[model samples]
Target: MTDAPLGRSAAFKVLTTGYVGSTGPGVAATVSYLTDAGRHLIFDPGMVASPEAILAPLAALGLGPEDVTDVVLSHHHPDNTMNVGLFPRALVHDHKVEYRGDQWKNRDAEGYELTPSLRLIRTPGHSPEDITLLAGTPTGVVAFAGDLWWHSAGPADDPVAPDRDQLRASRERVLAAATLIVPGHGAPFTPDATTPR
Candidate 1:
């Protein structure tokens, strides 16, 4: 299938795609929809290498760029935030300490509250200011772990982690808080279940 299955629950909903082989360096757009109090919000707009590739899949699902009220980035890497500039009208949110190389765009460092049920958590370690979207989903609270662990890259790669200690600590924190995880490059999984060690 060109797109991954999108699901919803009482608290929030998500169309998790882009964790495919065709998108940006093997990354694609993963869009989360949080509906509360008559308001709609978006989380982790997806990795942006081929701009149209990212937007096309999301658009086919009836979620357009103009509909985005806020773009919550899991991290500052190009794969995650490259096409962020596409949303001209939305407020962009990121961790205060994020390291942006050459790509530039409008963003906020302070943690944001799109609504009480949805927010950004500073789950750094993968990057200086990497953040994960902590929101209520079908299975449970899901953390969109960005590069915290590379599921397919194998144990020897350690998923290209720069800091071993921080990675472990980040994993633990995410594990403690989120029952479901939408990892950066894999299908959503349960952390409590046995994961690749």
Candidate 2:
């Protein structure tokens, strides 16, 4: 899982930064855009105020839904997969399957490489089906970790996690593997001493 920084390689952009209100009002999933090996990918096209919140940014990047070759769901949670159908032409990926045009293909997500620079790995914690998308970009390894971390400010532990121990271990693996992490509901962050394990 080590990669030297390349002069030109995969790249990623935050399409919409999400938020979790302290009082349970404001919320959305952080949608992301990634480009690797001529593939346009969307990560977690989930709950948002509107589809435009996600689409406008992609449009700004000169991409339409049809241009999205793939969409990766970090988990089956509504917040992480609600708007998956927006990308009509994309092959949707879950932890254990790939869906496209009414056909479901079974596959293992653990270490599944979508491209030389984009890979998927199971990191169940926030949910048993949770997975993470790791992108080897020119900058460094960027992990689109779902609620394995809700945000940079670790709740220390996920309050709703079925198994806190598994959550902790998953966090450790993500921390060890990614130099930058795009959490489920926050801006991208560089893990530091303050980051929870």
Q: Which stretches of candidate 1 lie over 4 Å from their true place?
A: 1-16, 19-31, 48-53, 60-62, 97-112, 152-159
- Each candidate structure's TM-score, on Cα atoms with residue i matched to residue i, is 0.71, 0.95
Best by lDDT: 2
TM-score of predicted structure 1: 0.71
- Candidate 2 lDDT over residue span 46-119, tens digit each: 99999999999999999999999999999988988889989999999989999999899999999888887888
Q: What are the per-residue Cα lDDT tens digits for candidate 1 across 1-197?
A: 10111322325445554464533346565555555544545666666456665567557657777776666777777666667676766667687532223445544543454555565666677777777766655556766666675443313236446776777676777777676767665556666445643
